[model samples]
Target: MRKSFCTTAILLAFGFVSSCGVAWSADAPLENSDCVKCHAKVVHENQADGGKHKTEVGCLDCHVGGHPPSTPKEDIIPQCSMCHSGEAHFELNNCLGCHQNPHQPLHIVFGDDNVAACNTCHPAQVNEIKDNPSAHGEFDCSLCHHDKHGYIPDCMECHEPHRPGQTYSDCITCHRVHQPTNVTYGQDIPNKDCGACHGDLMDTLAAGTTKHATLQCVYCHKDTHGYLPACQDCHGDPHPQLMMKKFMKCTDCHKDPHDLVK
Candidate 1:
């Protein structure tokens, strides 16, 4: 009886082994084969919109192990830092919060907290906003660039122009949107651009008969906004030293540089 029981057990174990081996051999190539066959959607999207991810890397580079049913999910879905390490942004634990799809990494949609991630790449723009805080600085980076990366919002979408006939190009001429109050412009800026904001001051300067009337606003204001140049900067003590000593201030006699009479 014992010998008969041992023979039956041996046969059952051998049959099970043979069946498993046949199944593995039949399906092995398909199972552990090209990823695109099963994950076609992921592959397609990655190819179309993956940005640097598609161009720089491949499926096996990230997967790193056996495919699907043979491989555990944790092994298949890699941590971003596995490849993107050594950077400050890579140190962030939850990459998926902003970069929702690893397959298409640059298809980013960020919330308020995630906006700071922009500083990782756009440090200059972030610093410009920090150095000169304004209404633009109060909002997240995504607030303006809501569509995707590299999108520049129309200023008119949120702000009315200072006056009629002003354009998007005109707004940027005097205002750096990141640092809106730090209004600086090139010499090419038209007097009309300045007149849009300082109409009264422009009128006062234009109405005068002095040499100041012949000069453009920028000729005196020079390179920066709200910059006050000393009379000595150009004229170099228009009065005698004795008269300068008594009068002390050029504005005391000239009244206003914009509308100078004498």
Candidate 2:
């Protein structure tokens, strides 16, 4: 009985020590050198252009548990959401489809339905499209940025220029493409671009001998498209207050700024 009790005690002590050894090995940090031996390509690619992943975390931080000869593939490979969560885009299950490599997350190639995911980072552009919608806003972001991120598509790809010599820059000068209808431009824009739509008005303004004919459309239109500036803004009370009372509207006497007879 005494020998049996001693044998039982030894087995229990051995089991306790074995368990401690396993726990210590599991808790130990992985050696980078060992990881690189098997995953040289992944490690190299990550080191080159891993963005925040390379700078912020080590391989073991993501890969977690045991490696080859011990851990299963399921145990070694981490889900993107394990570290990247909370954002609307991160909630998407198939991050690898566009991102391609976890090592280089920003090396993206857009896939179908991926354009909506852009709203996660570009809320301002999305909101601009939503609030002031146009034909451009109706289409997916990928339709314009088909190649990659930060690509600016030429307006001519989808629509003809407003005028003969108009370039892509000219289109954006007066039109916010995301909300194309909300046309606004700086003072530098020539009268010809505006004349594309207002041809009759342009012809009248050009034929007139008045000082208004000498100015650009932007001079009176000022900040944005379709803006009709008040005569008082430029010609402040041309007659007297009593004379102004008789002709409340500037057009009553001027006929029209575009066709001023005087």
Which candidate ranks first by lDDT, i.e. highest? 2
User: Against the correct fold, how does model 2 do in TM-score?
Assistant: 0.73
Q: Rate the local accuracy (lDDT) of all candidates.
A: 0.75, 0.78
Off by over 4 Å in 1: 1-27, 30-33, 50-57, 67-71, 230-232, 237-262
| Error in Å for residue 242 of model 2 | 9.4
Clashing pairs for model 1 are none
| lDDT tens per residue, model 1, 1-262 | 3234324543564432333332334345433235554356888888899887877887777877654445666877887877788888887757887788988887776766644688888899999998888988888888888847688999999989888988899889888889888778878776767888899998998899998887888887887998878888998766678877887578888898887849
lDDT of 2 by residue, 30-111 (tens): 5665555435789999999999888898887888876543566688888888888887878766788888888998898887
Error of 2 at 65 (Å): 1.7
Cα misplacement distance, residue 95 of candidate 1 (Å): 2.0
Which residue pairs of candidate 2 clash?
A: none
Question: Model 1: how far is 11 from its true place, Å?
Answer: 32
